[model samples]
Target: MKKVLPFVLLLVAVVLALVFPSVEPVTVADATFDTGDTAWMLVSTALVLLMTPGLAYFYGGMVRKKNVISTMLQSLVCMGLITVLWVIFGFSLAFGEDIGGLIGNPATFFMMKGMLGNQAWPLAPTIPLVLFAMFQLKFAVITPALITGAFAERIRFNSYLIFLCLFMIVIYVPLAHATWHPEGILFQKGVLDFAGGTVVHMSAGWAALASALFLKKRTTPAHTPARVSYVILGTGLLWFGWFGFNAGSAVGAGALAATALATTTTASAAAAMAWIFFDIFRGKKPSAMGACIGAVVGLVAITPAAGFVTVPHSLVIGVVAAVISNLVVLWRTRTNIDDTLDVFPCHGVGGMVGMLLTGVFAHQNVNAGNTTGNGLFYGETKLFLTHLVALVVVSVFAFVGSYILLVITNAISPLRVSAEDEEAGLDLSQHDEEL
Candidate 1:
């Protein structure tokens, strides 16, 4: 039953996709698709998709040898599972017609019935609607994969599988719709998220914190990281893929994309340096894990502000995020909570820093997206205040929503592995495989 469960679920999803009625195609107006933009989006989608395997390696290297395969699979399986979900109804819930400002009308694009090559997505006028959906699909795939780091090696495989579907449907879809869709409540309120500072990093980070608190500490003794080299390689890939992640949000092969790419590189490099220097000041040798985590935190910090902030602003954001996340990781180590891989400190805190700083440093000269208001440093208060409110709202929603999902999944199937499974390790116990 365990072996066939995924196949069964996948078959069901396929049947549903085939049976759902395809609504009549909407008449597209005079919008013309740009071949240049379409080409860039195609490349960008592939780059974003690469991040998941990179993530698998990144998370895999941090677990014990006995759990590496399971740890990696947690990240890898999302590529398969979320794709099916997205094709069925996930995209509809995210990018379908607005529903009361909180969600999309699932019927708007049910089963991707109306998302055809001829249709142009209103949000991205220059690209094909199909390409837009595919780009967004990559983002959906990676969000839940990020949460797996918090509970790594100790979660039941079946429970994690169940939680993945629930998280995407109940948490991610609404948040994405609310923040990115044109009529979304936050979007209407003039919130500025160039990429997914609030939708992706913040949601994943807060949920990770909740997972750690709910799961409690691991029963088994801690082990050293299985492979630092793998961590470094994964970091390199994530760094590479992030260019596509942030820049691609422009939805066009234009100057904005170029600016975003530049800022991403600067921020990541700045954060990596800051982390290593901070570690050295603490009397510890420079560590590969620290550098990788710091780089990723920087990437998270710049995601929301990539298009609106200048290159110099990105440097400051990276330095600040690195220091703050490093401190939080240190603080967390002293507490009873075992967050396995510090997902919350690095992603959650880093995302908050980015959102707030974007409110402070945003400049209209940098990009045309800042039509609403600039940051606090630019003598404007509205954007900063709005970001603060958003931070509170999103944090509460992600934490509370995720906790409820965890509880529900636990009720259906125990979330934690048995003590015997823990001793034997997740790779062998859960999947009957060993590294």
Candidate 2:
């Protein structure tokens, strides 16, 4: 029954495409479209799509040689699985008409209906609705992929697939709706996630922690990273692609995009430097792995504040985030919790730091769209308090919700590998392929 189930689902999807070839037109006049914005978004969408593969390489390099293929495949498979889920109903669940401010109604865009014509998302008025959907799809793709690092080398691939779907439907979609949908609770609460500190980073980070805990320690701890060079290359790709991930939130080719781009660059640079310097201060040699991880941490930290804070303050965010995340990594290594590649420390902690700092440093003067008022540093307390509330709420929700989902997934299909399989390496045990 399980063997035929996937084929049946795909067949049903094919039937839907054949049955409803033409979706109805969306609202918004054709003249409202801006070529420049559309063009930039097209590029942005492509750039964001590149990130998943970069993540594959980034994660692949950090796992043991025996498990490298399995680790990387976990990231790459999301490109396929999440993309299918997104096109069918994942997008709707995230961006469809609000369902009581918590989730989008799946029927609103079921099978991507109502995607034709000149419609624009309410928040992104310049780009076509389809473009906005595609751009957001990239965000959805990379998110669960980020959590893969936490349970690397120990999970069952089939079980992981089930968990991935549940996580997207249960966790990522709700968070995306609550943060990005205009009617979302967080949006209504004045939660200012310029990109996805809350939606992408915080949710994924917390889930990563939950996964690491649920999976427990590997049978035999994985050894040193297979290839540091792949990490460097992946970092470069991620750095390049992040311009779109952050700036494209502007939804148009405008000054805000430029501002986001500048801040993204500066924050990543500052974080890389801070990581190396912090390592040196701790009597550890500065290494490529540290630099790459630091740069990515900076990117994660600055994601929320990219468009809301100035460049100088972005530097502050980077430096602070790098030091904090680095410390968390140190702490995690000493603990029994075996989060491979330190996803919680680097992304979860970095994201939390970014979220809090956004509340602290965001200025109304930088983006007039910020009706939330100035951050705490500028003598306002509302935004920071709101963030604190959101932080606590989201952290608990993601962690607890994910652990439940993990338990459910494990019940359906055992999550852990057999000890024999674990010793043989997941590359052969999981997929029968090797790096």
Cα-based TM-score, every candidate: 0.97, 0.98
Per-residue CA lDDT of model 1 for 316-396, tens digit only, reads 999999999999999999998789998999999999999999999998888876767878998999999999999999999
Best by TM-score: 2
lDDT of 2 at 276: 99
Q: By TM-score, how accurate is candidate 1?
A: 0.97
Error of 2 at 203 (Å): 0.9
18-77 per-residue lDDT for model 2 (tens digits): 886656787766438889999999999999989889999999999989888998888888
Q: Top model by lDDT, which number?
A: 2
Question: What is the clash tally of candidate 1?
Answer: 2
Q: Give stretches of model 2 more than 4 Å off.
A: 29-31
